[model samples]
Target: MSASKKARAAARLSAVQALYQFDMEGTLMATLLDEFHRHRLGMEIDEEKFEKADVAFFDDIVKGAVARREEIDAVLSQKLASGWSLERLDKTMLQILRAGAYELMARADVPTGAVITEYVDVAHAFFEEREAKFVNGVLDAVAKSVR
Candidate 1:
């Protein structure tokens, strides 16, 4: 990826982390976003590249994820096994789904392939090859279903 794309990926990862924190901690949306801005030195991947524009982009992704969460989860839940609910998925994987689904649903400017590729890259950063493949498969299914 180009430098700006890499920067955007990092920003998305940070947004996912923030969302995961909120999911686990029950932090208010406004408070969590404020905390994210306030603690940039600690939470950010690259302080030098952080800008107001990136912050706004991250906010857009997070807000979009929250707004379309139920629809996204329903799409995901359909792909799960008989006993599994969306909440039963791994936290990191759920974050990936929410982030990917948000891009798929809300960002008309970003091609579906680009969105899936970016989130798969994000998954690969932390998961093993097999898990990344699983994420890729799930996201592929989600893109097709939601389209």
Candidate 2:
């Protein structure tokens, strides 16, 4: 990938983690973002280095996903299978859907395919290919609704 693409991909992944934290802890957005900036983005832990992420992109995804969560969740809920609710989803899975849905709804600059692929790749980090494909299907359904 090109530099910006690489940075954005990293940002998308980190945004999912940040959103997961937000969901579980209800951390104040400002404090959560500040913590990521100071300690997490591209920072090393346990002797492993993270990819350098686009700070602006990271902030936008985290803030936008949370800020527009109700709308995002509505769309996600619609896309889920029958008998499924947003609450039934894994927390990480919910954030992946939220972040991807936010981009599809708001970021016209990003192609639909890129958004789905990026989040699908993000899904792979925490899950098996089976779950990653689940991410793909949900985000694909989400893209169709928004874009």
Candidate 3:
């Protein structure tokens, strides 16, 4: 991948992780973002060095997703099948969905396909192919509604 593309992908991954952390820890967004920028991005952990990420893109995704979470969740909830609510989703999957929906709704510069693919890839990082496919399907539905 090109440097910028790789950076954005890494940013997406980081955003998902950060969102997961925020959900689990109840950490303030500013504080979590600062910690990620200063200590997490590109840092070595578990003997695996992190990829360099686009700081601005990372910030935009995390901040935008959190800022518009309720709106984003409402949209996601609508796209879900009957009897399937946002609360029923796995927390990690919910974060990925929220991030993808935020990008689709707010970042016009990113193509819809790219937004869906990136979040699917992020889901694969944490889950099996089943969850990745779920991310793809949900984001596709969300893109149709919002993009």
My TM-score estimates for the predictions, one after another, are 0.84, 0.98, 0.97
- By summed lDDT, the worst window of 10 consecutive residues in model 1 runs over 44-53
Cα lDDT listed for each candidate = 0.78, 0.94, 0.93
User: Candidate 3, TM-score vs. the true structure?
Assistant: 0.97
- Of 1 and 3, which scores higher on lDDT? 3
Residue-wise lDDT of candidate 2 within 75-129, one digit each (tens)?
9999999999989888899999999999999899999999999999999899999
Q: Write the per-residue lDDT of candidate 3 for residues 41-139, one digit (tens) a residue.
A: 878889999899999999999999999999999999999989999888899999999999999999999999999988888888999999999899999
Which predicted model would earn the best lDDT? Answer: 2
User: Backbone clash tally for model 2?
Assistant: 0
Q: What is the descending lDDT order?
A: 2, 3, 1
- lDDT string for model 1 (4-100, tens) is 6766776688778877887788888899888887876134445454433267778888887887788878888887768978777789889888888
